[model samples]
Target chain A: MTPQAQVVEVRAGRTRRRGRLVAAAMAAPAVLVVCAVYAYPALSTLAYSVSKIDLSPRFRIEGFVWLRNFINQLTDAHFWQATWITVYFGVMLCLLTVVLSFLIALLLNKTFFGRGLLRVTVLLPWAVPPVASGVLWVQMFHAEFGFLNGLIRAFGGEGGIIWLGGSTIALHSVLVTEVWRWIPFATLFILAGLQIVPKSVREAAAIDGAGPWRGFRHVTFPLMLPVVVPVVIFLFVWAMKVFDTIFVLTRGGPTRGTTTLNFLTYRQGFVQFDFGNAAATAYLLSALTVVAIAGLGWMLSRSRRLAGM
Target chain B: MVGTSLARRLKRVLMYAAAVLVLIVTAFPLYGIILTSIQTEPDIRSRDVAFVPTYIETEHYQRIFDEASGIPVAESMVNSLVVALATAFLTVAIAVPAAYALHRMSVPGRRVILGGFAAIYVLPTLLFVLPLFIAVVQLGLYDTYIGLVLPYTAFTLPFMVWIMGSFVRAIPVEVEEMARIDGAGLRQLMFRIIIPLLRPGIFAGLLLGFILAWVEFLTPLLFTSDLSILTVTLGLFRSTMDIAIGQLAAATVITALPVILITAIFQRNISEVVTAGVER
Candidate 1:
């Protein structure tokens, strides 16, 4: 209402505008880099999925063929097989890792002698690169001289079995290596969840004549699940797109047994030089990832609401 | 009371036993890799599997460093170092200001920017790498350090921004207000007050970014075919047939050492970063 107040209000507005301008300037570089590196490539891949492109001899983009690559992928038996294998591998790996890590987290939650050292030891597998771990496991499972066979032989049992040789077993062997690398990571998350459980809640359950198992089932497990579910979903999505470990361990394998959708895409693109088909497969894989991520986000929000209640 | 105490002791024993079992399972492969790297090639090939090496040798280690051995161990290591360091530095440099702005400033569409970043994080690397491979070639950047560094930076930026934003938001606004009242400019306020408080997040981002880039396999594999530009991870995969088992083990050790050390030193930061990212 007064002239003095009007002047102060205008000054405040100008200062706010200056602040907004500075923020925009600060954020421009990251936005530019993301556009150049991530958004551009992602959009190009979507475009390539529908059009034929050849990188060999010379780079050329032919006319668009709508849904042809997708149709070919859908009709191809190898694509379906790869899809089945990818789903199977992801489901099996997620279940095993979650169970094993939950048990490990339970054990680690209790105070014991040498607990600190044990924690570090448990995480050792995660520190190794997935590709290097694959190489190590391949040696460990070597038919003749591997430590596994040697142990079997020392126990007075037959020592030779082709661990990575069989079509069925190669995929399973790759699963084992991945489980080894991922369990510790999962355990760390679960353990952190465990620590956040209010001790008083479990104590109250105990005072009400509940036993350890009952208390954990009714109180601890529910509290921990909200934290653990997102982790499981994230790991499942990661396992679905697994490439490096399988590529190193089996090269998608003795008879394409371990060729999941991700590997199949790589094989089509790089090995077969069919960029269109590869992009199509990759886009299909992305669609699956998006579904999984959406499911995770929904679960997370629902759990947060329940926790708030 | 006595019965309950006895039960407690029994449970403690069982827990420790389980802990030891987990430790053995996790550590065995690491031990095997180290033992294999130090053993003579003949011993590695011998029918009798020695849990402890009967004859230890350093020849494999020497072979990796020797140019005459025809292994690109040294070159690959240098390449990995350059690319990883560049990626870490560039990611932090770009992410810090953006995270600060997003947190402190009245930026419109903050949620959309964050959601887009998270969505990019979830997308498979294969999805981007295919198109990126073609782009790099067309731009004449293939087989160069920039080829690998660009993708690595892009891949790491999303999570780095999230982590750094959390750090920025935790800083009390009153400190910035006081500095502003004292006539400090925007740069002065950030460098003198905000940046010092952000040390932990910045260090964590650097280490996390470095590890991700260091262990990356696919990007380097697709972007570069030159052996000289290959990272140790790609080299390890490439040299499986060409090198002896001992030398292969040596190379694996070389590739894994930095990651292991960084992880060990920054265990708290890493655990915090991962749990924060997921739990949020």
Candidate 2:
């Protein structure tokens, strides 16, 4: 209306803009810190993966040898062996974690006496600290003084199998420990999904003459995929990055059997003091992780957008 | 869904038995720890596994309160509490305003910050260890409370930003405009009006941040080694590395006691905190 009123309106708009600008200003410091923290090691590792590194004080820089580190990593027989073992370890945990937990979730969802108490108990391992879980599992899997061996003997099997002490048995020990720690997490997420699934939906499907298996396959299974798939994919990523449990129980094994990518990164950087090679390996791991996570997340977000969930 | 009510009842009976098995599998470790702690060393090693001890003793637990070290467990317990509480305060202090800016404000980089959620969450902690180690060493903050506290906050701040951002967005911007209309300045509105409304969000962020910081290990394990800075888990791990097997199990039970006690005591609040997370 009036010139003074117009000027006041514009000024008020700028001030409000400043208030909202606080979020960006605050976010700026955190982003810089995260990027700097994340990028330096990532770039350093990528650089090292290509070429050799000197442990000397001179610490000379070199050009990209172009996949030489990966070649070395892959070509060495031990490296290839470790890779296969790592792959197997990752797969067993990932599959068992997803499948068994899904079944347990379905079972837990049914009406039962003391169900609430059981749900909390399922989370006990999850609540237990990781290192403690590792210790417990190791002790249980121990050959002489361990529970599993004792139980096997009690049941008339050969006792004193070296679960963590034997090369072949060590990976199995690591797997058991990993599964123990993560099953609870998977169960929790699935249980959350089951809670969200309306009773009427499941009951109505049953009312429509679906068998128990078919009812789950059609009614509950589809309802669960949205929650379950993401949990599995995310946990798969975590399983790849696993460190403490394996390091604790096997310490890269009876003969480097349990050494994982992360464990190798630590060994290279800290133990070997080969910063360059460690940096390179770290970057490769980071690149692989970011690609997998970003790709899947983008796909999920797009689908969620379409479904408007 | 069953053809007959009798058949449906039978299915429930079978399910109940299976559920009992699952319950035992999960809870037995906890039972084992408490059982092992009080029993003599021979008792644990003798039986295939002792389900029940003939006697319960306080020697294992009381050792925490005994000795001249003034309960090493207590010190580490305090260390964990200090880090966790400070992490909660520091993360919220930084993240709340950042969230408000990102959620309420439409700046040039708003979309970039919002999209950062997935990137931040999925980035494994291992990748950052190298630089973070270097940064802490350079800052001369290594092995200090601040060293552990800062990184713990950074690790958890992403969740804070996301959860608080969603919570802030839900509350209408009308409240801020009302405060502004009353001649409240930017600082006034944020501190006086907006923050009170963000109580639930802040509480949620604090609980999540506290639990994460309290339980976190690798970062602290790598970065800090000072006895003063050792966490409950760290102490448990370091002690267990070379000691009596029963004592190790005892320590495991001891370390877990706080989390279990807290969760058992505040089950409702814990769920509420996670609920805020899932909503985001």
Question: Which pairs clash inside model 1?
Answer: none
What's each prediction's TM-score?
A: 0.96, 0.88
Please list all clashing residue pairs in model 2, or write none if there are none. Answer: A23-B101, A45-A279, A45-A280
How high is the TM-score of chain A in each model?
0.95, 0.86
lDDT of each: 0.87, 0.73
**Which 10-residue window in model 1 chain B sums to the lowest lDDT?**
B271-280
Top DockQ prediction, candidate number:
1
- Compute DockQ for each candidate against the true complex: 0.71, 0.47
How would you encode candidate 2's per-residue C-alpha lDDT over A118-186 as one tens digit per residue?
777777777777777777776677677677777778888887688887777787778877887888778
The alpha-carbon interface RMSD of model 2 comes to: 2.6
lDDT of 2: 0.73
Which number leads on TM-score?
Answer: 1
